[model samples]
Target: MNLIEQLKTILSEEQVTTNDVILEQHSHDESYHTPHLPDVVVFPNTTEEVSKVLQFANDNKIPVVPFGLGSSLEGHVVPEYGGISLDMSQMNQVLEIRNQDFLVRVQPGVTRTQVNKELNKHGLFFSVDPGADATLGGMAATNASGTTSVRYGIMRDQVRDLEVVLADGTVIHTGGLSAKSSSGLHLNGLMVGSEGTLGIITELTLRVFGIPEKITAARATFPTIQNAVDAVVAVMSAGIPMARIELVDTRSIQQVNTSLETTFEEAPTLFLEFHGSEAALQYDVAFTQDILKDYNCMNFAFEQDSKARNALWELRHNLAYSFIHSAPGKKLMVTDASVPINELPSAILHSRAKIEEMNLDAAIVGHVGDGNYHVLMMIDLSNPYEIEQAKILNEHIVNFALSKGGTCTGEHGVGIGKAKYQALEHGAAYEVMKSIKKTLDPNNILNPGKIFRDINE
Candidate 1:
């Protein structure tokens, strides 16, 4: 029997879908890469069902793509090759909350916000807050980080353990709750950012943190992007222990003001947050203001009330949407790259020059704490010239970042868009990755044509 018939025999008909509409919807993610519909889409409610499906696909030499809510910036979920798309949405369940250990166990489909809501009841919270309400599985797959990452670290840091299913449908647990260990191979680290090319994640146990006794947010404005980034570097260098440090260029500030229907200065801005006891947070914010003044900051203000802080951050968090609102019928093209702290000034300036040279409309924003920033370019994809210009500009940006001991992609994984540049960036390390992929997935049926092509073949 064919794979579909065999799968239907094992799972309920309602769980398996061959309908074209569903297939098309499951094909691509929130990326500009071309999409190809999967041959079938299946929603598995349990780990056993997922393993069974994987075993069937392995037997049939069918590719399996693990899909979340399809909010990925890269083409991670696009099923370029016809095969089974494993939708993990139905696996959205919070299995347990270990409040004492400051940890939580959840099915792969649980989202960051969902976990936060549950943890709030215990006066605890998960730190990894990628702006989008992305699934835990998707966040793990991409090693996603966001504004709060400056303080709490990335998604990988929060994950204490993962229940992974191998390409052959064998189950394995990666790590444990021990705070530190010189254990066996670092399987947890390996699985956290594998992008589903290595194994499928079934369950995740993540570390959490106690809610801060006090939290404060600030909005600081600078005359230019350089001043803003310089102040960010100074703050970090001074060991301020900021919970969040984000830079929004003047252009982005203007866009946000228009898009959000609020009036703010049309100058480069910094959104800062501090979390700690009342005494410590007070010292941090006061010192931060002094540091910004050294950089010639024009206007600086902070919000301590939770409601005001939420409104302030809500504006900063939705910077991506500002691009969408600015250009109603355009697709948003984002480039996330990181450079050395000192090199950031030159990098940002060069990008601005490129935008002007190309006569393009774009804005720059970044998690400046880590020297990671994105160039959000609104493009009318229908225009051939505009598409070509974007490609050229993006290529230049990636090359510049690499030249400065930086990566072509910071948060976005190598999902087809950046695949071609892997060899150029990794050199000898690229071959090692290919070898690893081959050892883990000999058939190349899992997320094929990504990261590295089969070199032996």
Candidate 2:
């Protein structure tokens, strides 16, 4: 039987397709990276089906790239070497909610928003909000973090256990349900950020948090980008427990105001959120206000109304879309670089300078609380000059961050876009990663050309 026929036997015929539209949909993610279509797309509805598919692919030496919602900023889901695009959406289900254990067991296809909706009923919530309603499997693969990462930690921290299917069809549990462990080699850490290079994630067990008694959101405007970033440093140094602290530069604020039709101050601003008891939030807000004054904070506004608070975050989360909307017929190339807390001010300033020097249409924004920032650049993909300039700016920003002991990618995984920097960022550790990849996937049939340029290389 042919590949499609063979896959149909594992899944229902309706679950396999080679339609042009379906292939196009699975070809790329929300990234500027070049896309490639898989020869066939397969939707596995269960862990056993996934295992069978992998077992067949391993024996035949065919590449299998897992697909989520395709909301990834990097080209993590692109089928660089066409074979099988494993769509996990069919398996999406909130399998179990261990409310007493503060954990939720879910299939790989469940989205963060979907999980939260179910968790809300139990007065619990998942904290890793990566702006997009990304699938839990994809989030775990990339080790994604967002505004809340400053306090709650990243995706890896929330993952209690993972039911993964290896390249050769062997199933393994990376970690157990215990709160902590020193039992083995820490496979959970290895698989969480592996980006589908080592294995395919079939299911996940994640830690969840109870709804806070009170949640307050505030925005603080600053005279300059440096001042705003400095204020972030001050607030973090003060040990204020902030649920979210995001920085939006003047250009980005302008875009937000223009797009959302809201009269926000056109200055470098910090969007802050605090979660705690009503009395505790009041004290933290007061203390945070006092500290903001030291950094020339122009205006400090408290968004007490829940509707207004949601609007505020909506504006922040939609900042990227605003840039995209403003620039028609252009693609966005975002640079994700994270630096040490103390180096954030200079790092952001340097990025702003580079953007100006290149005269590119870009904006500065970040989850500044954790020293990670992104430069959103809109470039004409068809124009070679524009693409080259964007690439140069990305290299400059990444090199600067590396110099300061930061990472080329803070939350976005090392997909094709950031693969070139793997050796530079990890050094001798890069070799160790390649060894692990080879050991797990000898045929290099799983998500080829990711993490490293090629497993052999």
- Candidate 1 stretches with Cα past 4 Å from truth are 453-457
Question: How much is the lDDT of residue 245 in candidate 1?
Answer: 93
* Alpha carbon deviation, residue 209, candidate 1 (Å): 0.4
TM-score of 2: 0.99
Per residue, candidate 2 scores C-alpha lDDT tens digits across 8-99 of: 88788898999999999999998999989999999998888999999999999999999999988889999988999999998899999999
In terms of lDDT, the best-performing candidate is: 2
Candidate 2: regions farther than 4 A off: none
Q: Can you write out model 1's per-residue Cα lDDT over 1-457, one digit (the tens) per residue? A: 7778888987888999999889989988877778889989999999888888888888778989999999888789998887989999999999999999888999999988998999999999989877889999999988999899888998889989999988888888999887778989889898887899998999999999999999999899998888888898899989999999998888888888788878999999899999999999889989999999999999998798999999988888798887887787788888888898888889988998999998988889888788888998888889888888888998999999999999998888888888878889999998888888889888777777666654456
User: How many residue pairs clash in model 1?
Assistant: 0
- For TM-score, the strongest prediction is 2
TM-score of each: 0.98, 0.99
